[model samples]
Target chain A: MEKIYTRPSYIREGATSGFCPGCMHSTVHKLVGEVLDELGIVNKTVTVWGVGCCILGAGYTTHDSFGSPHGRACAVASAYKRTNPDEIVYTYQGDGDLASIGIAETIYAANRGENFTVIFINNSTYGMTGGQMAPTTLVGQKATTAPFGRDPKQHGYPVHVCELLATLKAPYYLERVTCLDAPNVLKAKKAIKKAFQNQIDGKGFSLVEIMSNCPTNWGMAPLETLEFMKENTLKEFPLGVYRDKDAE
Target chain B: MEKRFMKGAEAIAEAAVRAGCRFFAGYPITPQNEIPEYFARRMPEVGGVFLQGESEVASINMVNGAAFGGTRSMTSSSSCGISLKAEGVSQAATDHLPIVVCSVMRGGPGVGPITGSQQDYWQATKAHGNGGYKLLVFTPESVQEAVDMTYHAWDYAEKYRNPVMILIDGVIGVMMEPIELPDMVSDEFIAQNKAAKKAAYAPGPREDGRKEKHPINVSDGGPMGRNHADWMKYEGWKENETDVEFYQTDDAELIIAAYGISARIAKSAIGILRSEGYKVGLIRPKRVYPFPTKAFADLCPKKIKGILDVEMSMPPQLAEDVDAATKGAIPMEYCLTSYGVIMNRDDIVAKAKEMLNK
Candidate 1:
């Protein structure tokens, strides 16, 4: 099988991207856009992008996109998905947007089993502005505000949402994967594909948390940033399918 | 024509089924519980969805959910319940959901009275999901009107892609009236809307894994998307006015504006004034939101000093709308706040004289 792959026809004509030289968000956006395009849902898919670095998703993707209030992507996306159930809707949020401020909306939507896909980019530090503490930032990981590393006494422990959501019955697919390496990026794509497929099949809520790298924010070389996310982030958020209805 | 002598609430539920409403979600509130219960029994027969939500908020959001899966869906509640639903209502209106909501009007800011009152007339028409957006509010005076207005609400909801509210206070909700279900709406109309729902959102394979991707899609990205189109869709609704049911405007001074059961009482009050050799005009608004602002502006009275806006709210919601219509050209007074059943004819006549005399 000579499957020399060319990107889907819907892939935009441009260089890799304007993202930081080795940024993982661009790869993640590409994978998601590719799936949306290949599934023939590019015209129908609506993506609600939350504040922070990912806020530029409306311009990044060709899907019908909406920018939401901070941490309100899930709330707005929930309403958008419910009203236009026919439309393929997804929300792209950073960990701060999904876990900290949007805790109620994210948890309830997953618990209620609202049919939609949520792509959580766990970069461990807020990337749009100067790096700061994020819910997913490692306990001992240092950032601008947390220059001394996230202290358990002052900062809460990192939240493992994929593991947290697995306890609920609503999610059809839940996976925590990373884009720090070639093999891991492929795995993340599979998880995203499954999430979108679950929505298409109406199985239930689905989410794929991608351990993305912010080279510039991490103050590390592109290769080092990838290695740090793999060695550090993946250790806290293990890479695996936390849930699948058929597994049981 | 399913000619059943039905209560106002029951007629509304049946008309929903007739109008292709397959999904209904509601919280149990006084006077409108029949609507939720009726749909509960009837929805299963036709393979529809009926859910009793944990709270009014969840109930409204549930309908919002069902409305997306491409069903002509609805929810019914009273004043308190609708108050709980305002957040979801704003989301629905902004998101432009084609959903029908039946508010069997009751009294209150906080669980005032359950029997019947048009006190919520203003809130139903104007208040927000606390966000200052408005929805279409229809006030039906009789059980027959309740049924037809509810059916038409579903029609207009899909047409406008926003929530449509049918406001009926307790008297109309509980009263049994003979209604001719003239088979006026065909099964084809039902099928057409159902088809629209399906085409809008068609389901594919599931955990079963034997299906293609039934994509969830909505096309809009800033300027190139449907956001502009969605707003343009709302502008057309401005043209379809359903208020101002006028009774004898010719050579009439001292006209009064009222709605729902109050309008019925206002008519009798007008007759009372006429016997005393005074020409009184009655203007009833069937649709309270697209309130007949233009028509009411015409009847500010050549000789009379002002118009009496009648309602059942203490602070009076209609006074504001009346002011908008008259541009404050005429001083407005209120025949206000019937906490339970509508104001009696004599009470309204007395209020009218007090306002007109002043």
Candidate 2:
């Protein structure tokens, strides 16, 4: 008789997500939808989805969405925000899509101080293509491409996206949070909401990188994936606010 | 408007702005760099946006995003840069977004040269991307036609909800010519068009109780149904969008086929041949994709002795289209110069004379 839980209006009703079990992309999607709803920008929001795992993101939300080519989401979002400055624009991308092929686009958009938010989901390995070594793969992490454990000499070191972006003067905010546990997920939600708020205030280039988990790709159970992220991945990519001009 | 001298690259950029294009995203490349340079100065004055993208791949994707937001958007690059944009252009076509791409052609086969060349004819007409989708390829022969084609390209793009390309060569891109620009589009008109497009196609529910549809999103039905629907739109384009320019094809012993800068040279050659008592004609395709198949088919093989395809590529590219259109009934010859060399009028005239003698 009483309604305990109702689907968010921005989320597609009776639709199941295509993410793998224990994948953090679905959770991030829900957080984005919730933030859009709370800020009352659902109608005027346009989200660009990168080519990897987030290509189908438009189907999950009710807002206007565009699917960008591989590693080009930030560039697309930059133009979208500039053309329609009053509307809210954001991009959902993974480490492989952002740090590997799209590194130049990512850096330039931040350098130009384009007014948009980027929701970056960084798992150690490439989840969509069956656990290949990503740009953010840990030093000793085992992946399909790095079967002998990632050797820094051969594969290079992991990219610290937040710290790298912090060196630039323009970005209004840059934070790295995780969704491994309930407390961390709450912190991540807060960081996301603040990023969106910065855009509403006309601050330029806000990015919140979420350290996510890929249980299926990591060859671990859902709970074990959380432990692996905290014990190993967090050491390389520490969770903290790497840059926040507003705080200064 | 008074006729003013302007470069072809600058004219196209001015024409796009006059056509209510509110967004321009492009990268710097030889022969077409003036296009982005012009936009960088003009966009802010008109309350529009101009962004020099990091690469051509990013530029096309940026244009796609801007178009999705209900703004008339465009991007420009040279041949090598256009190759980088092919993937994004294909995605824009599949997503049914309206964006204009101006490719100022240069030498190809791996950044061969920066000078003018028509080697990109096949790349523009036959295979723009991996997808089987075809773009409305407009070949402009002069600075005036470049302005005219670009001014109207946005309308055609929005009408069909497809990508349109203005294919020109470096000769036309860098050459200065006197042209009258089109009437300026007012801010109110741009706002009205953007609002109308958003109402018709923007995702989610509109005030008119119409729901926005995503034809490319496979979650609706599947990619097969969506692809079939997109192909139907392409079929409609074939019926109404084909355009060509005919010059003295009525009583001709030989016909010359060309487009873009090559067509300009062919016209000059035709003048010489006409004075020399040769009954030679020319067929220039204005729209290369819905290619002038009907124009080629209408040529009477009985009266027409042979067709000479003039281009700036080693092995002729447009000749292949002519071969298909004529069904191998008419004999075809080639007059070409590869490695970014512009076709000379004298060379085309000599080639036409030789073909006629044979």
Candidate 3:
């Protein structure tokens, strides 16, 4: 059977209108859509917008959208899956949304073996909130809030999502991909699709952490955002698949 | 009906399970652990869900989630646990989530003794959440009503979409008795109940073979946000406004305000007073929140020289309401509060003498 672009996803018309041009949410949504479409699990899926930028992301998607509190998407989805045994659940979160606010949710959902997928978009800054320092911000990186560069003392350290989540047993798929380059973009798409497929097979929690560029929030032009990803972000938060239970 | 034997706490738990409860979450606390213990095995046997939560906070929130998930969810606590639960309970009531909370009365203000005490009346009837809301608060005197109302509490919760509490004093939850479990909603029949429930509140996934996500919900509980106006529509359901009962208020010159075991004890005291030619009667509102004010219209105040309220809460909460609810009627008098047995007839007789002197 042939795969379809427009399936039963709730990500429908004009949701792209809600975001500013060059916003990464659309790219992330596209990756999510591409996966759900190819896997043929779009209908059996429920999506949670893990606070922040995707608060209204539920309105854009064609899948079932549940807007989770800043960090409670995974916890809510945990109970959601337990109640609806046959359904697939996915949580879309940004670094600030998942890593900082929802650290408990992020770690525990993976640790509990909850049958779901989480697409973590790491732009290294709080995009919707005007480029604040995220838990995933490259150490010593400068942003609007951390204008003088993030200090290891007062500002703490940047977290690595895939590395941190990799330690948990709940996840069947764990990967870090990026949209900074064409090939990385393609890999991130494949990773997103794989994560969703893993969930459809009842493989438990899976996460695809995408290191993407936030040109506007990074106070850089679109091109600089990509350059910055390579020069600064990549050096600090490297991109790669960190774990795969099936491969083991 | 007459002359039945039941342990106060067991009857409350059994009555709830008998009354179509399908979900329960709890954390064990002394005196009330029997509720979770009683339902844990029994619930699974009847195809229900039960989880001993990480803490009282989790237990209450989990029940809140399960209630919104469309099942009869309940939680139990003693004094300290109930305090930790104030936020969740208030949220549940404001959201009008039909949840049943059983508070097995224990000494309070901070991990006091685990022994029996009826000190939570203020928490139950007063508006304590983020909004001006009340509960479908029921006080059960006997084990039979404890069981019967435990089931009835679920129905009332659904009917009003509010938190319904069975405020059982320690004496009630701790005392043992032979409780008759009502005919239950059969396992197959539960499917029908669930279907009906899901119809009213299910958040569907999507039509295209994808699960539809129903946004996590608060039926009406929260800050004045998305559904504030929609929640206001439940105004007619404000417990105090649309519900009630009557004592011998028809020809009585004076009435006593009381509820729960205090009322049962008051009835005995009132009977003794009446025989001695005192025109006094016990006015117990079984539904404490829906206080039967209508029955005492003129008698509310400016009636006679004597009206009394009874309770077992420390220092006396029942007496305070008798004064407030009556607008200082006949200069309301209190029989005092001592948790052990609701009343010492001799002590109540002394208080009655004080009220009559006025």
Candidate 4:
């Protein structure tokens, strides 16, 4: 019988990912690898790994990979692309890495129009750190640090990264998508591909903010977490293209 | 090359280009601003990249990334800015990435002053980062030496796959002096250097054409193994790379231990004391991290009266190293200042006389 599915060639075979069960990080990593393999740029691509649950993603791909300290992936990726302009460069950052500690680097890289792609996984809570409150944590959401649910007065509000980055003039594309279900996962793949294509086309600065689930951190089963993200997380971080200069 | 009167900061930037540096990312800080300014105009001309990074933190990380990409990369900042870059520097050390960091130090302890200061000696020689990883620190006493040291810094960095720091002060950074610069490195040379180290760089196609599968994370090999390997690298550095320059140290009665601008001032005091029939010597450490402990051990404690540790910082940071090197067999005295004050040769002379009278 002919095989109906196979792992992307760009993904390392038999290497185990360290992402927690019920986490969306591995799915995103697989999608990114598939996209890179499809584009035939795996050898020429360099991925900057951010400090988060996805940090292990560096070892999962066949591309050259380097890790930056928490929240500095964009800054590091900018240097990689600037110095090696002919190569493709991208950063894989989590919400805490991009929206919090690395906000300055993320914003400035976008403003400078650095020709690169950013795959931002917004899973609300800091997954690797045991579900602590993150910048993208929704109001009334429960976290390890927010035992009584996140309060708008005390913990402030969830950051809409797509909206925030969309305000920048230099970014060629900015989109927010989710992977709660099969259909949404397909949409997220398309968004991620577009972001990578923007960089390939020499368009400056493209980011796809992926609304992801953290079932282990969210204290729910995998299926329950998907439902919760579809019902609640999607309302706060609605999935759509926030900005596309090409559409203009 | 022709001897040209160049400012210390400009000389360092030019030397880096001549050393085949093709990527520079730095933020403007007092005393070292001229470095980034010079590179801004010069890098493009040499087909290299010069970026004024968003902050010292970002700039250092950028240098780390460029270094990982197989390019000769660097960053510059003063003391306070260097403090901000400690995390990135530590990361680079952990990954064994080769990058040059130019710390043209101003007074610190928290932006204490913007003028020249040797307050960062302790920071550079020790505690540059957590994990106890040592930097091969070069303290240049003059613009010419600064240029020469900056040129060779990349080679040492790549040789060990470790970070190398060129430690200067605001005085040398802004001061102008005549210097013969190194020959310009050809683009071909830069390309060859990058190709030579391609295996160690990221996105690697290994020698057998297999893709690299392991992430360059320091946390690999568990905590114990990681720490052991990290220190092994430092041990290798101390064994093979320790360097110092001696001036009349063999027959001298008193030896002056100093570095950077303070060493220059100490040299002047040595000359003045020698003219007056005093036998004073200078032990200037070109590479401070290895700390030249062997050189200090080689000194005859029977002939030497004392070690005079001179610096431009109060509570004399260099004295700590001097005391350790001499193992308390020979007494050490300090002629020190802080708050961005330049070390005066006359004060050093006075201190030398006082130590002799004792």
- Total clashing pairs for each candidate: 8, 0, 32, 1
User: Model 1, A1-248: lDDT tens per residue?
Assistant: 89677664333445344567887888898789668766867666767777788865444444345455456566555655765667787889998888877666678778878789999998888888778888888999888989999999999899989889888987777888888777877888888888888888888788898988888888889989867866787788888889988587
Docking quality (DockQ) for each candidate:
0.10, 0.54, 0.28, 0.60
TM-score of chain A of each: 0.93, 0.97, 0.92, 0.97
Compute the lDDT for candidate 2: 0.87
After superposition, candidate 2 runs with Cα above 4 Å error: A1-7, B204-215, B218-221
Give candidate 4's root-mean-square deviation (CA, Å).
1.9
Q: What is the full ranking by DockQ, best candidate first?
A: 4, 2, 3, 1
Lowest lDDT 10-mer window, candidate 4 chain A?
A: A57-66
Q: Model 1: clashing residue pairs?
A: A44-B217, A44-B218, A85-B68, A86-B201, A87-B216, A87-B217, A88-B216, A88-B217
Docking class of 2: medium
Proportion of native contacts found in each model? Answer: 0.05, 0.49, 0.33, 0.60
Model 4: what is its DockQ? 0.60
Q: Could you tell me the lDDT of residue B269 within candidate 1?
A: 88
lDDT of 4 by residue, A80-172 (tens): 888778888889999999999999999999999999999999999998889999999989998889999999999999999889988888888
Better of 1 and 2 by lDDT: 2
The prediction achieving the highest DockQ against the true structure is 4
lDDT of 2 by residue, B1-358 (tens): 7578999999999999999998999988998999999999999999989988888998998898788778999999988899999988998888777899999988888887999999888888788898788899999999999999999998999998889999999999999999999999888899999888766564523444324355356433588876787788778777888999999888889999999999999988999999999988989999888888889987778889899999899778898889999998999888899889889899888988898887
Query: What tens-digit string does per-residue lDDT give for candidate 3 at A81-136?
Result: 65566777777888898899778667866887777888888888888888888888
Error of 3 at B211 (Å): 10
lDDT of 1 at A9: 33
Report how far residue A154 has shifted in candidate 1, in Å.
Answer: 7.8
